[model samples]
Target: MSNMVKIAMTSDLSPGTGTTIEMEDQSIALFNVEGNFYAIADTCTHRGGSLGEGRLNGDIVTCPKHGAHFNVKTGEVTFPPARFGVKTFPVTIEGDDVLITLD
Candidate 1:
């Protein structure tokens, strides 16, 4: 089972940008890609780096700590230094709110 949590508003994040959201003692990384929203684990699998502070290029986010790349839309490792993929959450937009499904 999963619960949809409202992480942010559409206006909170612009296209090609990302932010970190804290809820239920978990850190979630939210990204806005061309008006589409995606959610993933904020911590990089390789290191304890903040994925929210990473550079967003298209749908991929590059970790600032060691240059590891992760696909925000799928939470898959795209580049080196990170061998494992992070957890991905389904995103839903309702009116002005951005919600993500969390298990």
Candidate 2:
């Protein structure tokens, strides 16, 4: 396994919001639920939309383009037209920093 990268501070992300970070030529989306952090592919599985720009409701994130919903915690597709699931990264919180492992 590779080392986890410190993408952002835990305080950097607010609840029900997400931030985008670029790593290894891939865009990853980091979300904050209360104090917990979740990371997922920034690209939506359907229509190539940006997941970071989507809205978050509980653990589900709805794609801005086509209304595709995904569970940020598990990367599961909750609604269509997103039949495929996006990638999710492992996230850890160290003090005020949020760390994630990239593919």
Candidate 3:
């Protein structure tokens, strides 16, 4: 078992929505997709676009800056502009709190 951090409450995030939170000086983006939660690096790999501000279409999120697409579930690059994929963290939901594992 690794160290985990509580990022948000279940009530704070609705389905198909996302929020940004700070973790170890880095911004992490948390998304709620049909009751399941996902977390990834908030900045886009291409030009440092904020993934939290990007548009969410199903499990994929399009970067608002360079139009790059990433899967919230896997943090894989689905579209161009970014040749790399973002880092994904494991998420856990306890009661109404949402937790993310960084280790």
Candidate 4:
């Protein structure tokens, strides 16, 4: 079975914001869309830019380095210069805490 780790609480993330976290040698980006939480790889597929520091427009996140856009909900590349998609993790909310399943 895959192990689930508690990354942060709901209060830790505000709406339309994201945070970068290091877990088990992996860099993960935690996003708060509206009130729901989503997790994705922090590194951009096109370049080694930080996705968490990028701009959040609705569900789409734009890379600040090369302007590569990605959908946080699906982790799909939506813009050019980024042909590959980043890895996305399953996120669950337990009460006021946010948890992620990493495999």
Candidate 5:
């Protein structure tokens, strides 16, 4: 089973940007890509870089520490210094709330 946790409101995040969300068990990178939202594990697979602090271009986020690139929509490594992909979470917008599912 999965639990949906409300992280922010739709109005809180702007398009073409990202933010870090700290939960009890994990850190998440939440991105707003042209109005659609995506959530991924905040840590870069290469050197524990913060993906939330990375640069967002289109749907790809570049790791701030080492330039590893990840697809925000799927959490797949697009370009690498990091061979492993990060984990992805499902995001939903209900009314004005932005929620991510944790399993």
Candidate 6:
């Protein structure tokens, strides 16, 4: 099993916003929609844009590079110039810390 690594404090993220965490060999994007938190691959499937730097409207993220939209919670492609979906990661909250388990 993969170990869960703490990436950021819960206070560090806000509703309708996103952040990036680079761990070992992975780049993860974290999103807070209201009080719920979700995570996904930070790289946009549609041309490698930084999804963490993308715009967030609800749980949908518009890729900064090419306007591809993805669901942060599901990593599903909602609108895209590219057909594939990025990977989604599981997130958990421990006190004020946000943790991710990557495999």
Best by lDDT: 5
TM-score of candidate 2 on Cα atoms, chains taken together? 0.95
**Ten-residue region with minimum lDDT total, candidate 1:** 1-10
Model 1 whole-model lDDT (C-alpha atoms) = 0.93
Residue 11 of model 1 has an lDDT of 98
- Could you give candidate 3's per-residue lDDT for residues 6-101 as a string of tens digits? 999999988999878988787999999998999999999999999998998899999999899999999999999999999999999999999999
lDDT of 2 by residue, 1-103 (tens): 5767889998788898997888878899889877688999999988999998899999999999999999999999999999999889999888888888865
TM-score of 4: 0.97
Candidate 5 per-residue C-alpha lDDT over 1-103 given as tens digits, one digit per residue, 9 for 90 to 100: 8898999899988999999999758999999999999999999999999999999999999999999999999999999899999999999999999999999
List runs of model 5 lying over 4 Å from the truth.
none
lDDT of 3: 0.92
- In model 3, where do residues sit more than 4 Å from their true spots? none
C-alpha RMSD by candidate, in order: 0.6, 1.0, 1.1, 0.8, 0.7, 0.9
Kindly report which residue stretches of model 2 are placed more than 4 angstroms away from their true locations once superposed. none
Which pairs clash inside model 5?
A: none
TM-score of 6: 0.95
> In terms of TM-score, how similar is model 3 to the real structure?
0.96
Segments in model 6 whose C-alpha atoms lie over 4 Å from true places: none
Candidates in order have lDDT scores of 0.93, 0.89, 0.92, 0.92, 0.96, 0.89
The C-alpha TM-scores of every prediction are 0.97, 0.95, 0.96, 0.97, 0.97, 0.95
lDDT of 6 by residue, 1-103 (tens): 6888898888988898998888888888989889788889999877899999999999899999999999988899999786899998888999999988888
Error of model 6, residue 33, in angstroms: 0.8
Better of 2 and 3 by lDDT: 3
Candidate 5: residue 84 lDDT (0-100): 96
